[model samples]
Target: MTEQALLLVNLGSPASTEVADVRRYLNQFLMDPYVVDLPWPLRRLLVSMILIKRPEQSAHAYASIWWPEGSPLVVLSQRLTDAVRPYWTEGPVELAMRYGEPSIEQSLVKLAKQGIKQVTFAPLYPQFADSTTTTAITEARRVIREKRLDLTLSILQPFYDQPEYLDALVDSVRPHLTQASDHLLLSFHGLPERHLHKTDPTGSHCLKTTDCCQRAEGAVLASCYRAQCLQSAAAFAERAGLAAGQWSVSFQSRLGRAKWIEPYTEAHLEELAAQGVKKLLVMCPAFVADCIETLEEIGDRGREQFIAAGGEELQLIPCMNTHDSWVQALVTLCRRAPQAL
Candidate 1:
């Protein structure tokens, strides 16, 4: 029997919490055209400026979330790979990162050396983003092209609205909803509004209005993170049997000075607190695994901000990391890839 390979990838973390390591990681990450999407000289200047200060601050943020084994994202990714290995009868399962160490190139090389003929690239981003999934695929393609390998490649596009994914998300959060909370906040990582406008084929797909994401009839919803976020929130709410006004969506993790998709998570926390909505439950559906963004930003700082603004009981429902349902969903995804291709 010929061997096939499956590679799972994610937005990577710095190897260590050291400032220099963080700078190097940020440089590689932010330098990707899909990530920054700016011209060379300008992007270079901007990245350099950020590298000087951002790394130190990022290092501190990472330190808080770092596990004794390693970064939570990488560690959980590896665990997921392990959990899914038994389900892949075709061949071995490996993990890689879109940025940082144990890169996609190295993973491909290892599989190539084993004479693998078919490879599936699963860039584990639930939502499609040029900066995330596209960049990983481009780099994997570049590696295959450079090596002149004979491997056939297939990429797992976004599964933000997939039923299995929705089930896994519901399973992850259902238990937490038992507690009393004013509202359920589904916070996704934000992308710049300009990116959405540029990517919109019809030029009017995303008007940043409340009604903009409610368009479920067209194909525009495929690439719209805002729409997907809302849909996931709805699915989770329905599965959890929550009322309509009991939940809302927001975006977080904005970069640069550009305006990103709103209502921003920080701003929403303030608004909710001011509106006398105490005891909130927050969940980040954008990330399948808990990392710095969720652990530090939402769990720590977000909670502090909510409390400081006159709210109480901020609870963060963790991502579906190494959960049986998530691992099973991943197995199902990989198993169906050969048939889909």
Candidate 2:
């Protein structure tokens, strides 16, 4: 049997939490056109300014979340790769980062040397975003075009609302969602409002108006992160038997001075606390693995803010990292893709 290779790609982290390494990682990550979406010179100027101060701040954030083993994102991804490898009878499994080390090109090259011709590129993002999924796919294609290798490539479509994924998400958080909590907050990472408007086909697709995204369908709003996020929350809520008033959606991890999609998670927490909500359960469905965003921003700072705002318990449910059900879901998704080459 011709061997196939499954390459799982993720948004990467710096090799270490060192300030210099963090700066380098941020420079490479923020410079991508899909990421910053700014003109080169201006982007460089802006990044350089941010790098000067952001790295030390970022390094501190990372240190708070850094696992004894390594970056939680990298460690968990490797664990997922290991778990799925035994199930894939026809292929080898590899992990790649979209922006840091073990890049897409390097992973493909390694697989090629191992006599693997058929390759499947699985962007680990559950939702499809030009910045996340497209960047990874474009890099893989660029490598293929440049090398003129005999490799064939298959990209995994985003499965944000996949039933298997929903099941896994529900299973991951079900244990923590008792009736005691005042409410459940399904928070996702926010994108700039400009990005949604820039990418929307009809321009009116995302008015940021109430219920606007709830009414959108088809490719008209495919690139709208807000729409996908809402859908994911709805799916999980439905499957988890959450009542309408019991759960809500919010966005987090916003950077810069520009306005981003709302309602913001931090603000929402304050509002909930003010509204007499004492205990809360928070879930970051946008992230498949725990990182600085989840660890420090949400788990630590977020929790602290919630308590300070008059809330009692702010319990953070962990992401489905290397969990058996999630691993099985990922392997099943990969197996369904046609073998390339």
Candidate 3:
């Protein structure tokens, strides 16, 4: 076996909780063709419109959740890297962001300079999507190709339904379940529904109806983000031994007016409160490490909304960041030989 370096990647955050920094981050994030998927000219126009007022608003949001060290996403990702480094005795471990500094390019360059010949890139997203897992892997391959680096690269498969991943997720939430909670909500990041059609290999299985994603098969599961999210939820609930009605799933952080995957997180929070759920346990499975979305959108504001709507307590479960089981799962995922680019 060749000596290999491990690179962990996650969605990025603004450089700082400032308007200029946030604007710069948004530009890089939104300009990705895979993310917006519109024609270049139209995408640029839409992004420009969004930047006009979004930066100020987004900067505030970032500020509300910003950790004293830095963005929670970046900090927690680094912590995960440190935790996994000891296990990866084969080579060094490094962390990168899909949209900011400590970029994939730089991480790869560092590995190359260390005379590492094999690299296994682990995208921190548990479920696959064009914008998240796909884009991160695509960018890494691009850097290798364009830079002419003499290195072999492998990428992690989405671990949504992987037994180890499911088990780790279950372990992370078991302690929470032991506490008093009326409901458990599994929230994955939202993607436009059209994204499924664009990725579906059969072209006829996605969004045909409410049950289509639930019955996804073969290549469908590989590309169907919603189906993978749902799979994770079902597996988790089963492993945790929760009754059918005790837990449910929802999507969060939707952008644009285009129809996104249904059961929005905020709406579900309101619904749970209305249903007289006094104690709610909200878990973010899409993220291995908590970010602004988990900390602010779900923890801070979500708690406020749930209480205002009529709830006693809304507890945001910490993500599987640096957990012993999660670290083991990462090791096993990275241990696989280079399978697909």
Best by lDDT: 3
lDDT of each: 0.87, 0.87, 0.90
lDDT (tens digit, per residue) of candidate 2 on 85-176: 99877788999998787888899888888878888889988876778988998998888889776788877877887888889888888889
lDDT, residue 212, candidate 3: 93
lDDT of 2 at 46: 91
Tens-place lDDT digits, model 1, residues 233-272: 7887887788988988899998889989889999999999
Model 2 local distance difference test score: 0.87
> Which tens-of-lDDT digit does each residue in 105-169 have in candidate 3?
99998899889988888898888899998899889999989998888877787888888899999
**Candidate 2 TM-score, true structure as reference:** 0.96
Instruction: Identify the candidate with maximal TM-score.
Output: 3
User: Each prediction's TM-score against the native?
Assistant: 0.96, 0.96, 0.98
RMSD, model 1, all Cα superposed? 1.6
lDDT at 301, model 3? 92
